[model samples]
Target: MKIEVSLLAGQQLKASFADHEIISDQSISAGGNAEHPEPFDYFLSSMPMCAAFYMRKFCQQRDIETTGLSFTQEVITLDESNPYKKKVSMKVTLPTDFPKKYEKAILAAANTCTVKKVIQATPEFEVELVK
Candidate 1:
């Protein structure tokens, strides 16, 4: 649940969490080597991925087949005055044969994603320089 991030060469950043490491970097045009996903990419991906996890869990508990389950996320920018994402759309595709009874439950499960709740709540942050 804890992550430590440090600057690497150029615009690369390394983040370590739960005994694993992940890298983030800008594109070559953005002064980075583009070796890994950029910070914003990770931010945008967090919601859908979290929801997907819950969706899978919901299917598993119901003994439902998940062979064709898919989730795609898209972001829309509101205006030039705001450079951040204004809206996020997540599309979930279930197998045609999937049970109709579980459809609403599945959607509810996806809404349980913690990251989505955090984003909606707009948590506050405290930043300070430490030595």
Candidate 2:
């Protein structure tokens, strides 16, 4: 998959991938228009969203009800010495009346996020100016 990122004046940037377009901006204090989500916001959201997709699939396959299901994600920087990502955690909340038997399976399913796996693998990236 290929993505294109373009500057749109000031500190705003637009990223286009396939049929989707995501706008990234900085806060006024950060010298941006604050018109859209910051780049870090997208990065943080990717994990939970990917997990949620698998969670939904798990429920659908098992004929489980998806009402009142939600998740919370938290990021913690363990060591400032290690720049970039330090730690990411997610908590999946099931409905009060959710079946107890599926708890383990649900947790397992949510942990199957492809994004999380990729981050764990720590893929290498190469950056170069486009000619």
Q: For model 1, where is the 10-residue window of minimal lDDT? A: 78-87
Q: Candidate 2: which stretches are off by over 4 Å?
A: 80-85
In candidate 1, which residue ranges exceed 4 Å CA deviation?
Answer: none
User: In model 1, how large is the Cα lDDT of residue 55?
Assistant: 98
Best by lDDT: 1
The per-prediction CA RMSD against the true structure, in angstroms, equals 1.1, 1.5
Error of 2 at 4 (Å): 0.6
Residue range 1-131, candidate 2, lDDT tens digits? 99989999999999999999998999989999888989999999999998989988998998888898988899999889886647776899998888899999999999898889998898999999878
Q: Compute the lDDT for candidate 2.
A: 0.90
Best-fitting candidate, scored by TM-score: 1
lDDT of 1 by residue, 1-131 (tens): 78999999999999999879989999999999989999999988999999999999999998999999999998888787977638788999999999999999999999999999997898998999999
Q: In angstroms, how far off is 68's CA in candidate 2?
A: 1.1
For model 1, name the residue pairs that clash: none
